[model samples]
Target: MSALVEVSELRTWFDARQGGKRCVVKAVDGVSFAIHRGETLGLVGESGCGKSTAGRTLMRFHNPNGGRILFDGNDITSGDIKPYRSRMQMVFQDPYSSLDPRLAIRDIVAEPLNIQQPKLPAAERDAVVVENMRLVGMNSEALSRFPHEFSGGQRQRISIARALTTNADFLILDEPVSALDVSIQAQIINMLMDIQERSGITYLFIAHDLSVVRHISQRVLVMYLGRGMESAGTDELYAHPLHPYTQALLSAVPTPDPKISRKKQRIVLEGDVPSPINPPSGCVFRTRCRYAESRCADSVPEMRDAGGGHFVACHRYE
Candidate 1:
């Protein structure tokens, strides 16, 4: 299947003044990946690893400092994004803040339609809103209520409903379940998966939850300090992680089976994550990597295929 979205050497940096010195923070530095038409590509990493920045840049919510973003074979890195807005929608992480407090549920769900199809008749638009709300397991009764009347999960459902109003084929889900309760998270995940099965929608599921990613994604990409460390099929990467960072991350995931948990050896990484503004030389992960060698600091390792399309960027693999 052809890719619906392809990102090449994508970079998104920020300028800041620190102690009277202007510095640049490479939030998403030379990251690259592709999402096939109807699959979820999980982007996992620690907090402040530029996972959110990468998602926003893909949506053009943040202008990338460099690199290319192609949607359905068309370059969408720069230019008026209005034409692609309806085709590419985002479900942000925070449900409470994402919804407008002042707007009723009907208006909130219909906002995308209003922007994309301003001339659409009110009755027809209302029908579309009601349809999408129903798709997300909501009813017309909630339309008159404000955002404050709903719970976090309900608000997220509303957000999903709003995104679907555009009939979006691709969704950039930025931690859509992190803020919800555990039971609610499962419900939301199942709902999202069901939505995908029905609509054939593609997703870039960004989250730090390895377990959640394992459940929803067919492939997983591990990132560190604004760079991709590894990318492979979910089962392959989970069963046999190559990069040190990837190994450490998977080792930390809690296992429900006491027998397996006892047999598992956790790989605890040392030291705090380095600052993005002043990252380490060469490989960004070298500072905290247990297998770091002198060569790791001398030059960056290029992503190489180990076998079966499993790719890793580490000197050990080279």
Candidate 2:
């Protein structure tokens, strides 16, 4: 399948004042990836690692400082977003805050349609909203209610309905299930998978939860301090994580089977995540990486394919 979304050397920086001094936080530094026409690419990282920023940049929520963003083979970084807005959509992390409580469910879902399909008749737009709500397992009765009336999971379903109502082929799912209870999370994930199966939509699924990402992603990309640490096929990454950061992350996941969990040795990372405003040179992970050598402190490691399409950006892997 062709690449529905492609980003190359994408960078997003934030201006902040630290200790009364100004600095630039490289939230998404030189990240590159491709999402196929109908595949889920999981982007995993700790908080402040820029995974969310990358997703926002892809959706044009943030003005990209550098790199090229292409959706369906068109370079969007240089053009008017108004024309391409409907083709891409985002399901934000917090369902509670993402939706406006004042708007009725039908109007909330219909907002995108209003912006993108102004020429469509009111009846047609309402029909699209009703259809999308049904698609997300909500009924006509629920559409008349407000977001506050629904549970967290149902609110998220409403968010999904809003996104899908635009008939978007690409959806940026930014920690879509992180805020829900485990049971609710499972339901949402299952619902998402079902939606994908039925609609053939492509997803950029960003989250810190490895287990959830592993379950739904065809490919996985690990990020640290605003840069990609490792990327590989889902099974390949779980089977043999090459990057130290990736290894540590997978090690921390408790195996479902007690025997395997007991047998597994977890690699505990030390120190807090460094500030993106002044990320470490060489490898941003060197400060916490046990495998770091003198050379690791001298030069930034370039992402290279070790084998079997697995890529790692670490000096040790070189």
Candidate 3:
């Protein structure tokens, strides 16, 4: 299938004021990737590793500092973004804050329609809203209720309904299940997959949870300190991670079997992530990497293909 979204050298920096000094926090720096039609590409990273920023940038919410955002093979790097808004949508991390508390579910879901297709008759728009609610497994009675009336998972479903109401082809799912209970998380995940299978919607699943991403994504991209560390087909990445960081990350995942669990060597990374304003020279992962050498500190390693669509960025790999 053809790419639905292609992001090349995407960068999003924030001008942060700290102690009267202005510094740029390179949230997403020089990232590049593509999401094919009807495919789920998982984005995994640490809390501050810019996974969320990358997702937001794709939606043009961050106003990218540099790079190209190609949607459906069209260069949308410079445009009003209004026309493309309907084609792409974001399911934010927090469903609680994502929806308006004062608005009923019907109004919440219909808001996107009002903005994208303002000329739709009230009855037609209401019909669409009710249909979308049902798509997310919500009932008509609940549509008249507010956000606070629902559980975390139900709220997320409502959020999904709102996003899908636009009939978007590409959806950015940012930690969509992180805040929910384990059972609820599974429900939401299954629901999301159901939607994709039915609508052929492409997804960029952003989260720090490796197991969840591994389960849902066809391909996975691992980020560290706002840079791409590794990317590969999901199965390949979990089986043989080329990048040291990727290996360490995978090692941290809990094994199901008791025999293997005790034998698995957990890679304990040392030191906290450096400030984004002044990231380490050369490989950003070098600071916490146990295998760092003089060569690693000399120059930034270029991301290169290891094998079979597995790309790694580390001097050791080179």
lDDT tens digits, residue span 44-82, model 1: 998899999999998898999999999999999999888
lDDT for every model? 0.93, 0.91, 0.90
Please tell me which model should have the higher lDDT, number 2 or number 3. Answer: 2
Across residues 186-263, which tens digit of lDDT does each residue of candidate 2 receive? Answer: 888888999999989999999996888988899999999989999999999999999999999999888889998998
Candidate 1's displacement at residue 238, Å, is 0.9
Clashing pairs in 1: none
Ranking by TM-score: 1, 2, 3
* Clash totals, every prediction: 0, 0, 0
State the displacement of the C-alpha of residue 188, model 3, in Å, after optimal TM-score superposition.
Answer: 0.6
Off-target runs (Cα >4 Å) in candidate 3 are none
Model 1 ranges off by over 4 Å: none
Model 2 spans > 4 angstroms off:
none
Clashing pairs in 3: none
Q: Quick one: best lDDT, which candidate? A: 1
Candidate 2 at 70: error in angstroms? 1.4
